[model samples]
Target: MNAQTFGPMSGEPVGPAFYLADEEHHADGGGTMLGFWIYLMSDCLIFAVLFAIYGVLGSNYAGGPSPRDLFELPLVAVNTAMLLLSSITCGFAMLAMEEGRVRRTQGWLAATALFGAAFLAIELHEFSTLIAHGATPQRSAFLSSFFTLVGTHGLHVTVGLVWMATLMAQVGRHGLIQANKRRLMCLSMFWHFLDVIWVGVFTFVYLLGMLR
Candidate 1:
């Protein structure tokens, strides 16, 4: 944020970018959504760079296992389904919120959290299995790139689950007020964004990796 020196025009209130302490100013919620979109775009750039790195280094097995030798596509497919279904439940939660059904919204949020947790569980199991078979990140450049790309995504989902649970608790305590609605909208976007990213991961990393 640039410092605003006092001038002939310095009496005006600061923009949302420069000021966030005024909750009343942001009660309309436009600034919050725009800020969230900016954050998502930044997140997209990070993932894009990760994908490019994987494309370059994913083949450097360093005399270790290749994707076909390590990737369990069946298990990965199941994990993908869990995440994709969680997106659906997240959408349902948003709908329930719009309808002012607090209980239904919380229920769907809980479902989304469960599905997200299952996805993470499967991913961790896959990681442990690979490490058990000596396919750790240090084993090869391929494994290094693989873990970097996929693990970053898993970390995001873990954060989303935590956020979802906290938001659910807030909704339970406060109902579908304006504040909770704004949070619900933000979480909906985040959950769906992760689902889209996972589709790319499943196709580019898992499916195409198997083909390699």
Candidate 2:
């Protein structure tokens, strides 16, 4: 007697079975990059709106403080240098990651975190000084937009610093595995994006505002 093989659901012969390739099971990192890029684009929109709002309300100081009166170029320049330096250090970290030098990558990440923290500190000081002088957001339309724009940027830096720290811990434990590498790359993009945005802020919001 001949016995017939049947499929799971019906009495039909099954064709050859197929399975996913090993490469198909593993991520190629492109999805991560694409998703991060989308996030950056959305963030760009947020910053663009803030920039527009600032442009419109910047002159509406309501007889309160103005950018030239509040902005200290020297301090802002130092803060900008810190963020720019962090971006460089983050690049070095990515290079180290590529080389599979886990410790070196961690060291560079630490340096980047330090620079980022310094930038935040200077920004906080500036904000405190402004608030002390009654330049609170409620004081005028200009102050409202100014704080909204710059404070939002500062908040992003803070989040980046926190993410960097978490990634450092992950690398310390996992030794630059694929997942960790992807995270680092995303963070690299984020850190550099913030640096670019700061340049715009320094120029459009500070330099031009001072001129106005």
For residue 86, what is the lDDT in candidate 2? Answer: 94
Q: Which stretches of candidate 1 lie over 4 Å from their true place?
A: 1-25
Q: Which tens-of-lDDT digit does each residue in 32-125 have in candidate 2?
A: 6888899999999999999999999989988888888999999999999999999999999999999999999999999999999999999999
Local distance difference test, per candidate? 0.92, 0.92
User: RMSD of candidate 1 to the true fold?
Assistant: 4.8
TM-score of each: 0.89, 0.89
Residue 101 CA error for candidate 1 (Å)? Answer: 0.6
**Candidate 2 regions off by >4 Å?**
1-26
User: What overall lDDT, based on C-alpha atoms, would model 2 receive against the true structure?
Assistant: 0.92
